[model samples]
Each structure stands twice: as C-alpha cells, then as structure tokens.
Target: MKSSFVFLCISATLAVLTITSAAPGRGNANATIPANRTQNGTVTCAGLNDQKKALEGFIAAFVAILFFGSNFVPVKKIDTGDGVFFQWIMCMGIWLCALVTQLVLSFHPNNNNNLNQTVPVPFEPEALLGGFLWATGNMFCVPVIKCLGLGLGMLIWGTVNCLGGWASGRFGLFGVEASLPGNEAENFSGVALCLLGVIMFVFVKSEGKKTKSNETDDERAHLLFSKKIQAETESTTLKDMSKASDDLDDSWVDRLNPKVKKIVGTVMAIAAGLLFGVSFDPVTHLEQSNCHNPQNGLDYAFSHFCGILLTSTSYLIIYCFIKKNKPQVIGEAILPGLLVGVMWAIAYGAWFIANANLTQTISYPIVATAPGLVSALWGIFIFAEIRGVKNLVFFSFACALIIGGSVLTALSKS
Candidate 1:
C-alpha cells in the first residue's frame, strides 16, 4: 500500500518532467540542430564523423532514458536475492572495464608521442568539494529509493540537487549552505514558483542581431582574387578560422549573467537529479527477483551488466560529442565519475543486502531519509545553491512543505 502511493507520486513527478523539458530537444539546453538548413534539403550522407555523431546521439539518449526508466523495477525484482554482491560487483566492473578500454585505445595508437597527454591543472579544492557533495548525495540515494519509494525521494533530493546545480551555474561550484530551513510550510510553496521560473528561463528565446548570409561570400571572392594576384597558395577562410576555437576564451565562465545562470543551472540540475534518482529503480528490481532460470547465476550478472553497460556507454558517447575536447576532459571526468559510481554502488548494494535480510516496507525508508536530510544541508552551506534573501525565505517555505509532506506521507504508511 505504501509502495503504491509512493509510485504514484513518482509517476506524477516524472509526468511533470516529461511535460517540461524531459522529452529532449524542446529547450535551448538541447542545442537546436536546424533542420531547414540541411545540405540539399536532406541530411547529406557524410563520412564517419557526422554520421557517427548523429547515430551516437540517438543511441546515447535511448540508453539513458531506458536506464533511468527501469531503475525502480529492477530493484523491486531483486528484493529476494542473496546475489546482491555479485550483481553490484559486475555492475561496477562493467563501468571500470569501459573506462579502461578508453584509456588503452587512447594511448595504444601512439606509444612514444605525448600528443594526447592531458594538461595538468592544480587540483581546485572547490571542484573536489563539489564532487564530494555529489558522491555523498549519490551514496544516500539508494536507501532513499528503498524508504521513500521513488516519488518522495525524488522530490527531496531533486529539489536539493537543483539547489546544488543552481550554485554551480552561479558560482561555478555546488556546496554552499543556504541560511533557510527547508522544513517550513512556506518552502513547499517555492516548488511551484521554482518550476515557473525554470520554465521561463528554459523556454524564453532570445534573438541576436540578424545578418545577411551572403556578405561573407562576396568578401571571400575578393579575398581569393587578391590572394591569386599575390600568388599565395592559401584561402583566407583558413586564416580567419585558425584562431576561431579560442574566441570564447576572453569571456569568464561566470560571464553567463550570474543570476540567470544560477537559476537555469539549478533548474536543470534539479530536473537531472530527479530523473537520475528514479533511473536506477529497474535494475534494483531485476536483481531482487532472483528469478534465475536453469541457466544459472549468469542471468543475474548478465542482466546487471546490461544495465550498467547501457548507462556507461551512453554517457561516454554523449560526453565525447558534446565536449569536443573530450580527450582532455576524460582525465577530469573519470576520477569524479568513479567516485560517484562507487558511492552510488555502495548505496544501492547496501539497500539490496538489507532488503534481502528485511522486509521492503521496513528497511528502505530508513536509509533513504538519512541522505535526504544530509544532502539538503550540503546544498545550503556547502554548495550555496540557494539565491537571495527572498530565496532564503522561499527555501524555508519549500523545506517546511517537504518535511510536512514527508512526515504526513510516512505516517500515512501506518
């Protein structure tokens, strides 16, 4: 009975995400690939670069959506198994294997040349702190799933995660503490307002001054004619674009209008955390079922492998394309990703072990709420994702509603 209501709430929350930017390509965050500007009015069949990129996008999104959507079901299915250790080991192993493969391939092509070496930057304490908050939050998520069921955990963590994200957008980091209490009734009201503010930011379109497209062509012809007279072998386009990529270097990362960045990043992160919170449920269920056939325990390992593979592969593909200098970023991302992965693995693995020893209704909530509250504090003080004085008041109001709702929901379980 408790599970059903929790599931219902989660479903409602997911519906909201789907309606508001969850489905993809509906907002600015998803870079708009203009269809009308395609070559010959059709997607030109290009070499591997463009084709690979296009296919990768589709595959990555497909895997991600599937991975997130099925998390609850898998956890539920595996509720009866003693195989938690094996399942988790294989899942983490799968991701590690993938990472190893990337490293091997990167260095294998040029054993002597250091062309692909990463530029070392001093470890920034702020980035590490941000990563720690994420790792800790992820560690807490597993029990949250078990206890709060899917919906309420999503609500609590999702909101707090948003606060962390907003901080990242504003201050380029996520662990500051907000002075406001999250448990006041007024805090709940902020949820609706926050949602509205997010929609406004995401959906609002801005136009840059339009320019004539052909002006460049005429200029190009004149330059080419001049080049021919000078007997130069090069085209001017090559010269103009030689220093193009670094053009944005002059701008500060915080140049993104701090207030707007804070709001948008917070909203995006919150939505992402909410979606991610619900993503692992399916795998949890699959492991719990222990419905291993005559084929053996390989079924459990294989199924778990499938889920992790989908997630890790999808992430790699997406990050590779979206962050063009991915080779450089790989060093930065891997350690953090591992930290997050292990934290997440421990949380979910522990939940499975506990579920095996105790009833689903009793053990899950305890673990879930522990991180629920901890993450809130981390977001406020550590990440400082919350905004102004008014936001502090709003945060307090939302926190109250969240606490009241959580209490009421928990009490209703009896």
Candidate 2:
C-alpha cells in the first residue's frame, strides 16, 4: 500500500512537470502556462490551459518538488565506493532512460514529412557538453556527502545551483539570453528570498564530523576490549592507532585536519552546484544562440545522457588508476546506486521537459529547493545527523525561507 502510493505520487509529479512545462516556449511560474513567443516576437504557440490542465500542473508541481527533493534517499541506506564506481551506475541508468525516451520519440515526427526529423533535431555540440558539465559536478558528490552529510551539503550546493541556473537565464550569464515571461522585479525578488534561505541554512551546524570522531579515536577500541584484553590490547591498539593516524596524515585530501576536510568538501559542493547549474546551458543556447542548430527533444536528451555516460566513464577510469588499479567495488551498493539513478533519471527527465516548457528563470529555483527539504527531513528523522533544539529552530526557519522564496518566485510569474 505504501509503495503503491509512492509510485502514484511519482507519476503525478512527473505529470506536473510534463504538463506544466511541456507546452514550453514561454511561461510564467504561476500555476498556468503562458503563450509561447517565436524568435521574431510573434506568439507562435497559444499554450492556453483549461482549469483541468492548470490544476493538474499545480498538483504535478507539488509532486515534482517532493520527488526531486527526495530522489536521493536510496543512497543514504547503502555504503558506496569513492563515488566513481557508484556514479557510473547512476549515469548508466540515466542513459538507459534517455535511450528509451529517444526510441519512443523516434516514432513521432517533429517536422513536416518533408524534413523527416523528430523534434529538437540536429544534435548540437553544446547540448552534449552541457551533460558533461553536470556529470563533472556529480563526481564530487560522494566526498561531499562523506564530509558534510546530505542536509548541509545539499542545502549549500542547492542554493548555488538554484542561483546559477536562475541567474544565467535571468541576467543572461555566459552569453545565454534570459527568457523570463514576467516582470523583472518579481523574478529578482524571488531570487533574493532564495538567497536569504541559503544564508540561513549555512549557519545551521550539521553535527557531521562527530560521526567520524569516534571511529578515528584510538581509545574507542580499547573501550570495547575486556579488562584483561584492554591491558594486552592497549599496547597493540596504541600501535595500530598510531599507524592509523599516520595513514590519515599521508593523504592530502583525506588529511587529519578537520578544517581542511571541511574546506575541501565545501569547495567541492560549491563547484558541483555551479556545474549542475550550467548543465542546461546548451538547451538555453539552442533557444537563443545565433550559431545554434536546434535539435529535436529526443536527440537532445540522448546527447545529454551520452555526455553523462562518456564523462563518468572517463572519471571512473581515472579514479581506477589513482586507486592503484584496485578500485573499491561494493556489490551491495550497486542496487542503491541503481535505484537513485533511476529515480534521478526520471526527475531529470522531467527537468528537461520543464525547462523546455518554462524558462530556467521560472523552473530552476522551485526544482532546486526540493532536495534540501527532503534531505533535511531524512537528516533529522532518519539519520539523526541534525540535532539540538537550536538547530531544529533554525531548520524551521530555513524551511519557511525556502517556501517563501518559492512562493514569491512563482508569484513573480503571475
């Protein structure tokens, strides 16, 4: 019963993303789809929706927010490798879904019978590069999780991701043009609220490193040993402990300095978010770039996922040699990785649809806020990574900020 409801919810969420943004071309972030404009400023597609469509779109947005927010839940249960091997599995699932989508789209004709092509055809180079950019950011995920935990890590990066994706479209960063359908103040104010939320989240300590503090403590093992065993094991454990400390001291990334680890994780998280934000730059280029060869949606999806496959494979191969040809492989972790891959593939697939249907200015902020909500819930209830009355209060405040920002952003479209 529970599983069925979850599946139903997922379907409904995908429906919202597909229905709300599916018509694309032009849209306000409110519960409605606006008419799409052509390059020459003429209304090319009407995109007017009945109440039924509007309602469905609203419901689907609700579902999408939850699903996108919680899609990474599976990864929390299992132990993954240094991220390369696990990332490969996730990318494989993304590609699998994209391949299926492409095959399905091949049956449909995007152009008239004369052109004989699907929608968004021509397979632009920039579109493929966009996927690679996203994959590069994803490569740092595991290390960030290990150090920062999901709640804090996702919050920090999610903010940056939202800002980057939204800003590029809002202000036309990187030569991509803005396609916002509403007043500028409405959109920018929403962005400000979102930024305020991110700032609030940053001050909330995650109690993350404490989880590892005991594991690294030399006397932890001594406490587990019996009285007589403690006496004998003390010498052995102390020696082993010294060796363990030495081992930690050897690696630059995994060094014994907590401050350094925190800094590395934070930097990686920032980079990951920035990369993810730019992942859709090619799609924007297709719409706005002068040299762009607009391809069909199917080809775009295929090329994007292909980038994920190609880039992830290269990263995994590089990591294999770095690990001295003995890469860590956990058979048990594969299932979890696959699960996240499938879920993320679906969510991301919807993302493309949403992007096509609505500009990044309207969609990215709402989509980005979800994972933090879901992950923070997991962190608090499932993992106990977040604790203390003070932090909980901050968590509540953060949630309010996110909700307020999202609502204002949506209203900006109206």
**Which prediction has the highest lDDT against the true structure?**
2
Model 1, stretches more than 4 Å misplaced? 1-306, 314-330, 350-373, 383-388
Off by over 4 Å in 2: 1-64, 109-122, 145-152, 203-252, 256-263, 290-299, 379-391
TM-score of each: 0.32, 0.74
Q: What is the C-alpha lDDT of each candidate?
A: 0.35, 0.67
Lowest summed lDDT across 10 adjacent residues in model 2 is found at 23-32
* lDDT per residue as tens, model 2, 53-137: 3344344455556667666676664557466788898888778767766665554454343445544334456678888999999
Q: State which candidate has the highest TM-score.
A: 2
Locate the minimum summed-lDDT window of 10 residues in model 1: 19-28
